[model samples]
Target: MSDGERVEATPIDPPQPLGATGEWLASCREEVARVAAGFQAFEISDEAGYRDAKRQRAALRAEVASIEERRKSMTRAIELAVREFKDGAAEAVAPLSGLDAEYKERIDEWDEACRARRRDELEAAYAEMAPQLVTLVPFERLAGRYADAGKWFLRSTTGPKAMASLEEAVSDVARNERQIGMYGLAPEEAEAMRAEYFSTLDLQAAARHAMELREQRERVRALDAERAEAAGAPPAEESRAVASARRAAEAFIERDAQAPALEERQRYVFEFELSADELMSLMRFVRANGIHGRRRRAA
Candidate 1:
């Protein structure tokens, strides 16, 4: 956690300046030039250059160190600016996300309305057929009647009669089709009523299916909401604040981008001079603004 701790070794590169423009790179030009000049002064290329560099490697190292230090400052400053900008951007987009979610919920309600209406229409159609259905016997009832007849026909014979009753079996089944209706239904009407009964059953099934679908959708939405809350737990007001910060930063950044190079440098200096309160505001602004375009564009 120590700020001044040496953590890792890395290759040194020319440092760039931190700003909306390339001025940050320019600021560290002196450090880069000194390193380059040392390499050149020692003629560090072939046998002679290698020998000279090795002999004066200590001096070369000092120059390299200076360049590295300047590079780190530039990198650190730019990172801070970028971090701030993105935080602001995240805040700005949050409100828009909420609006988007509201619109989505409305769409879901509309879809459920359509499904509910369709389900009602099916049930209504089914209800209209109920009167006719009650008049006719169901297929199951007809089967049960046949089953009862079988019990009688398959009865164990008494002492005087030990044979199967063929007459009973044929008679029971002969009237099977006609017996499907409570009233004496003609073949065609009986078939039609049978179909209508099935249609009623189908409607009942469809209504149940629709209800299940609606319930499933509700469950999914609840799960999604829970996950979203757990991820950030951001309240409505907090989200709006982030959104507001993002927009402000974006607007400020746009204006700042148009300023002259000197004015841009002044803004960078202002970053250092920021108070704690101002720094937070700046972080939100810069984060929202999407600074550096390198680390934040993808985000």
Candidate 2:
């Protein structure tokens, strides 16, 4: 009687929380309302407003599509730019001559400038289209916290412990963004940070280079195998000598072609003034030891 009476005296409220899809739908509805309001507010007599409304409607329709063609195009452009810069760097400094030095500097400067400019342009473009993009989805379903009050209530009811950590992570991102904006970093700095971030995500030029190198290595292995099959056995001394000479000639040609670009790249790396030699040495060590492939056994 005591427990039943106490429970009856204190009525429990039913839990109400918005799920991910619910949040998205809410956001989508909010976006549609906002856009509708904005369109309504436009002066009917003004030709500019009429044009703007038409353009915005078209953009909103595009946003309704699951795939964003414009964003995909921009991302592809950035990827291409990165690839071009990398290839240019690779081609600039093989022989390590003074001419190569100048070329290296020019290439590096141009590449860095291009990256900064491109990133800024992309950011601006995104900002202009953001409103339309928002309208494409319901707000509640955007896949982040703070979309609706129901999410908070749900978290509080179901997983109270995780609420603090989630809030902290969101706070951390906000703090970082605030710091970045406050610092007013140079375009070059911003671009560098962007590149670093993408690199961490395995989306950078170096990652592409690594893949290309692996493909080249595979081709070389295939050629070696084909040669072995055709030859059937070890060649006589004279033939072996001829094959050695041929290999040496090919190596010399390859080195000659690669030298200028490598030297230029080295100079650019050195310009950073951050122990470029040591870094290159480490890179070579990693390649020679196959560190990327497997862990080495202790000698």
Candidate 3:
């Protein structure tokens, strides 16, 4: 056809199918239903039962703390025993010190590993809980919308009435959007959902969240290792040993003092007097770090 006589080309068919809007809305509704189901399973409520669950969680945390404290005490005791054995003047203490040294080393190693594992477990739990929390409000709203829709559908009859009901359904859809908007869903989630409503079924955002959680878990694990090593070390008593050594050295200059030289007195201070304090400090440090002091062997 001549350019001037050419008919204007018909507009290319739209990329999406006819009725795509309705299909998208339907998919959104299904997602809303899925989320609602999950929330229902979660059994979340601001009721007395939820309060009781919180109390139970608190109690469990307290018990975990107690167990951790006991472990620290045990570690400290072992460290003290070792220090005393090493510095005690008597030959009888040497064997006991050796045993304590071995025990302390083993326990510290195990504690480090356990601390890492605990951190990982807690990280995973926190990550899982985060997404669920985000979904809660949206799901609740969706559940309410579905209920209203079901009620409206049952009593409606005429075309005008059905159109009114459809408008209500549109409002319900808008409400869902508003509810989810508060979560600040990752841009990717919004983009994917916008591109294809069916993409909501994919949990890529949740997986990304899980990966971030794992990174945090590893960071915590490394920190725990450093703290555990520091706690396991002999306390300030090492400095006290040197001070005692110096004092004993000066004693030789004063005839009336009659104290032995640094070498001889150093053993007495480190082994007999400071061991208990060193052990106590170590125990307190470990407990503060939330490391379980007790060795739990694999069954």
- Residue-level lDDT of model 3, residues 127-186, one tens digit each, is 454444324333333324343543332323443454444445445444544544454555
> Which candidate has the highest TM-score of all?
1
lDDT of 1 by residue, 212-256 (tens): 655566566656544654464433333444556556656776776
Distance from true location, Cα of 271 in model 2, Å = 20
On lDDT, the candidate that comes out on top is 1
Evaluated at residue 277, the lDDT of candidate 1 is 35
Q: Each prediction's TM-score against the native?
A: 0.29, 0.15, 0.18
Evaluate model 3: give its TM-score: 0.18
Task: At residue 160, give the lDDT of candidate 1.
Answer: 19
Q: Rank the candidates by TM-score, best first.
A: 1, 3, 2
Clashes of 3: 1
| Candidate 3 Cα deviation (angstroms), residue 170 | 1.0
User: After superposition, which runs of candidate 3 have C-alpha atoms over 4 Å from their true positions?
Assistant: 1-156, 184-186, 189-299
The weakest ten consecutive residues by lDDT in model 2 span 265-274
Give lDDT tens digits, candidate 2, residues 1-299: 46456433456332222123355556667766775665443555788878887898777676555334544654566566667766765676445567778989999888677645543443344335444433332222322333243233232333333344334434443354344444344565545443442333222343345446555665665456445535653432333434444445456556656766553322111111112222233334334443343322123
